[model samples]
Target: MKLIDLNPQGGIGANSIYLQIGDVNILIDSGLNPKQAGRLAMPDFSLIKDISLDLIIITHCHLDHIGSLPVIMRQHPNAKVVMTHSSKMILDRMLHNSANVMLRQKEENNIPDYPLFTHEEVDRCVPRFTGMEFLQPQKFKGKTDEVEIMMHHAGHVAGACAVELHHKDRHIFVTGDVLFENQRTLRGAQFPSGHFDTVIMETTRGTTERQVGKERVNEVSRLIASINDTINRGGSFLLPVFALGRMQEILSIIHDARKFGRLVKCPIYAAGMGMALADYFDEISRKYQHVQFNRNIIKELNIQPTARKLDAGKDLKQNALYIISSGMLVERTPSYTLASGLIGSDKNTIGFVGYCDPDTPGGQLLQAKQGEDFTFATANVTTKLQARVERFELSGHADREELAEFAIQTQARSVVLTHGDQAARDWFTKELESKMPGSKIIDPVPLKTYEL
Candidate 1:
């Protein structure tokens, strides 16, 4: 088997992999970078432009995983795209939202190459998508070779999956952004326990250790208590989240807390793509039984939409809980704007609940010491970071130790690492090498091809 990393910049953005097994050619995913603009954000399709792709597998609908699907589909018209059934249900909506965001960015940021794919293009790509069920093997034929593909539940989001492929006697497993611990809206990963010839896995949480009392259940309780503390003190709490899964899961957890009277009585405000996607989550919960989100959670919580225009560096002082998107607090996002306003005041609190890239504003804020001056360059606001900034261990990705254990158990002859920063991948490399001393661990450089 031969493989190439098509994500030119690597480090978790524009995630794409090109693999050739026998005569079959496959593209795992084609994502876009959240921080970069224009064509720079997408995977370098030029690397595979001349090769005719046989299959395109989608692990989930996260923007960082499927953001550039339309572009890739257009490039390889004959390729068949496959994902879990639940992902297919929500895939078009996610792509349409991406298109809208790109359109808005093109105007707001004055970028000439924005809106890389239009709504019509996404609509056309919808028909080419084929949804598969868990553990159901589907065979695809190339010019002279055939491979069987199956998906397993990967608990990071509603429709996330881990791919398993079989070609002759060689077996391959690809863990695409997985989480073993269950979340409120979704169950934990249900991976098969066995050996494979090759294993490819994500190293998202490689550098972070799960501290003793910071487990998911305790973290939920702590989050509720902190929200009550902030509201009682007449300050608002901001939770920047990823709209696809984290938003729905957090909403469900908050609802459970409020239902049991553990949460304080305070107005909850949520808006943007997350709220819009709630209906889809509800449908997926009912139709697919993969997710457990309900639209009624919003009604019961008396959720209100955030104001259309939030003034930078001016606190709203609503003393409410705000759950907004762009989890990394990317520039010009709703959370970014609101954070600028809230971070200046000692009364407010900003809590993060998911993974944040070290280069993003969220990661920068996490590393900043209290009383330091933080700048929101896009908002033109620079103020002392007086707000209480906290992080709860409620990330969607699996813990590094758990992931390492899973990789060790596979006992594959070769292990490939993807979807993490340099430090994170280095940690995985060391751990895997120490545990599986005889295995060939390859961290392929971007655009480089390696044979195994």
Candidate 2:
């Protein structure tokens, strides 16, 4: 098999992969980088512009996985696009939201290349999407070769999946953004057992060691306790989360805490595409057995919309719980602006629940010490970091040990790592080399082709 990493900037950004087996050419995903703006945020489609793609497989609906779908679909009009049934239901919504964000960025950030694809372009790509049931084998023929494709349930978000490809007798698996542990509203990943010829996996949490006594259940309790402590002290608590999966999952967890009287009574403020996605999650849960979210949770929690314009360095003093988006606290986002105002106060709390890229504001804050000077550059606010900054092990990715064990158990002759920073990939490379002496471990460079 021949492969190329199409993400121009690499390091978990613009996550597109090109694979060629026999006469078949496949594209795994077309994602945009949240850190970069305009055309630079998208995958380098120019690498495969001349090649006729046979199939496009969408692993999930996260912006980092399917953000550039419309761009790729426009170039490969003849290629077939496939995703899990649940992903198919939410793909359009995610893309439309992305387009809207790009349009706003174009004006706000002064990027002329913003709005890479229009809403109409997204609509045109929708008719081509073919949703498939998990583990159901579907065959696609090339000029002289064919491959059977199947998707397995990968517990990261509502409709995430890991791709399995069978070309002739050689088996290949691609682990998209995956989470093996169960979350409040989603079950753990249900991957197949056994061996394969080649394995491509995500190494997201490679640098994060598995700590003892910090499992999901315990972490949930700690989070609730922290929120209660902050609320009772008459201070607000902020949860910076991704709008797609994290928002819904965190809200569900909080609802359970309140239902059992384990949480304190305080005003809950949440608004964004995530709130709108609750309706879709409710629909998905009712129609499918895999998901477990209900839109009624919003009503039960008495959620309120966040104030339209949040001023920097000015706290509202509501003593409320704020759950907002741009999980990594990207510049100019709701979380970034609100955090600027709340971080100077010693009474407030800011807790993170998912992976944060080292280059993002959230990661910088995590590395900062209490009473240190922190700067919110975009908001023009600089102050002493007095607020409580905590991180829960409630990430949406599997632990490094579990993922490495899975790859080692597969015993694939060639193991390739994707979707991680350089440090993360390095850790996985060292771990795999020491344990699996006979296997070939690869970390492909961006836009570089490798034959395995």
Candidate 2 per-residue C-alpha lDDT over 340-410 given as tens digits, one digit per residue, 9 for 90 to 100: 99988989999999999988999999999999999999888998999999999999999999999999999
Candidate 1: give the clashing pairs.
Answer: none
Our tally of clashes for model 1 stands at 0
TM-score of 2: 0.99
Tens digits of per-residue lDDT, candidate 1, 200-270, equal 99999988999999998899989999999999999999999999999999899999999999999999999
Q: Once all C-alphas are superposed, what RMSD does model 2 give against the true structure?
A: 0.8
State the weakest 10-residue window (summed lDDT) of model 2. Answer: 271-280
lDDT of 1 at 262: 94
lDDT of 2 at 354: 95
Q: How many residue pairs clash in each candidate at the backbone level? A: 0, 0
- Ten contiguous residues minimizing lDDT sum, candidate 1: 285-294
